[model samples]
Target: MEFLWTSFEIVGTIAFAISGALVGVSRRMDIFGMLVLALATAIGGGIVRDILVGHFPPNSLQTGFYVLLTLAVTIAVFMVYRSKQDHHMSTRWVRRIYLTADTIGLASFTVTGTSVGVYAYPQYPIFCMILGILTAVGGGMIRDVLAQRVPSVLREEVYALPAIIGSAVYYVFGYDGAWLYASYGSFITVFLIRTAAIRYEWSLPRVY
Candidate 1:
């Protein structure tokens, strides 16, 4: 179980970092800006979750591994973008890459957050689900705010619904002694729904 959780965390961090770095590259940011955005998008939600759960100092701060990993990923992204500066990458292709990375990050963090929340407060299933959604979207929200864009959670996109469904799946199956099933099930649910939304241009109804 611990190993599975750690695997999700590592995957989430890397995927989120890649998404953030891609955003930075699109914005023509420098290496430092890319690093900052990547770290914020990669670990912001985990840190917020820790604080909300009374885990002072946060686990990411306690260990340097996540920072090192984010740094390495951001540097790699920067190098790749720099090397490809002469090429004409289409906006559609870049958007596709970003969506894929963001979806993976969302799914991975949804599992980790719901698992931690359930383990921490097993009696409060609703709270666990909400925590999972928040954890899934918090970093992306921060990233969008830093990038001066409207957060996707507030957009018409079919975004948070996947997290909600994924969180519910984890909370239901995770407590049945089938941790692997629950984790993978939740991941697949989110990934599929999010990808479908991207492919089909699904959106929630707008009030205005």
Candidate 2:
């Protein structure tokens, strides 16, 4: 179970890093900026989670492998996109990648965050749920801040809501059940909601 959780975290980190690096590229950011975005988007949530759980130095900082992985993934994504000059990177392509990355990362982080909470605290389901949402969205929040854009989770479109729902589901089912079922179901729910919202251009009403 621990190994499976770590695997999901690594996968989510790589996917989110790729998405963040792509954003940096699209925004014409320099190499350093791109790397910064990649690192933040890859490890920010784990950093927050560690801090909240009182894990000094954080697991992300303790393990150099996570940093290397994010860097390698970012570079690989950039190379792949750069090499494909003939492939037009339309808004649709960018949107598709972003949505896919966001969905997968969200689901993976939700599970990881909830698992950590359950393992460490075990008594606070609300805290576990909140941590799950934070883990799922913290990196993206940091990425958006660095990019000078509103965080997607803050917008109305059932973004963070999905994390909340998924966390609750995990709490109810516990970790003993089928891993793929919970993870895939949560991801599909989030993806469908987000895709529908985008298709309809839905937005929360502005409050004065």
Best by lDDT: 1
Q: Give residue 60's lDDT in candidate 1 (0 to 100).
A: 74
Could you tell me every candidate's TM-score relative to the true structure? 0.96, 0.87
Candidate 1 wrong stretches, greater than 4 Å: none
* Tens digits of per-residue lDDT for model 2, 123-202: 78899888888998998899999899889887646678778887877666655566556555655555566666667877
Please give the RMSD to the true structure for each candidate, in Å.
Answer: 1.2, 2.5
Residue 182 in candidate 1, Cα distance off native in Å: 1.0
Clashes of 2: 0
lDDT of 1 by residue, 6-74 (tens): 999999999999999998988889999999899999999888778778898888778799999999999
Q: 169, model 1: CA deviation in Å?
A: 0.1
Model 1 residue 159 lDDT score: 88
Task: Give the candidate number with the greatest TM-score.
Answer: 1
